[model samples]
Target: MSGEPLKKAQESAAESPRALRDLIGYHLKRASAWDLHNANAALEAAGVRTVPMSVLLTITEKPGISSAEICRILRMQRANIVPVLAELEARGLFLREADPDDNRIQRLFPTAKGREEAQRMLGLISAHEERMLAGLTMAERDELRRMLAIIWREDGEG
Candidate 1:
């Protein structure tokens, strides 16, 4: 094979299906990647990663909630959430205790430090979101959330 042909192929852009960019899945994946990158940066200052931030916030909002509920609400696996919960606990951000009514289950709650940290972290995250949605009006943002909720509802039905 001629080196010229090989070089041209190597320089070519990724070959994907036509209209890929127009697809909702493609846009969703790209938007998620961008948001994750920006969110992670803000999360780092709080001494935690994305998952831990989520866990902390959930605990703050629903104190004494069980780990099983957190897993269900986040649509995450036990194996994944276990480590994140451990990290948060180790950092003194939250605590886990055996449920009083159900001794078999463990409940999570944020400590005083956890609540303060979560408030700061949430502010940073909110700023990042505002920048990402800068082009959208308040009405548009509300409509977008409503549309996303519909998809999420269908997800549970399936």
Candidate 2:
């Protein structure tokens, strides 16, 4: 393997600087990108992208949730979630109905088909999660999840 040393050198050169690697945000972003990429690819066959998948899951879990509530809970901008919601609506994944308490607020609800698709998506998500966390022990995975929850809440509050 004459090229092995050269490949090693090239990879070493491409490694992130220590300062970047030390940053929590950098690690979070890298991990987020990796997970999102894998999830998107795995769910593509279901005609669901990452954002839509998230929206669908949230809607399924919290039926009659408003778009604003979703944005707040998910830390997504209204503008960004709008297009995703529109796409989901167009695809018959969910429907917006006027809230009984406040007609001005539109509540989100998954259609019957959407509920079925959400179940399928959950299975796909579980597979993707397993693949992503394959190297980690069960304890490690649980700890990582706990750490992430702490970070998520702290970051949102800040």
Q: Which candidate number would show the highest lDDT if scored against the true structure?
A: 2
lDDT of 1 by residue, 1-158 (tens): 23554454334313545587457787577668889999998777776667888888999999998888998888889889888887888889988789888899988889999999999899989998987777667988899888877876744564
lDDT of each: 0.81, 0.85
TM for every model, in the order presented, reads 0.83, 0.82
> Model 2, residue 55: displacement in angstroms?
0.7
TM-score of 1: 0.83
Q: Model 2 clash pairs?
A: none
What does the lDDT read for residue 89 in candidate 2?
89
List the lowest-lDDT window of 10 residues for candidate 2: 1-10
| Cα displacement (Å) at residue 151, model 1 | 1.6
- Candidate 2 residue runs with Cα over 4 Å from true position: 1-14, 155-158
Which candidate tops TM-score?
A: 1
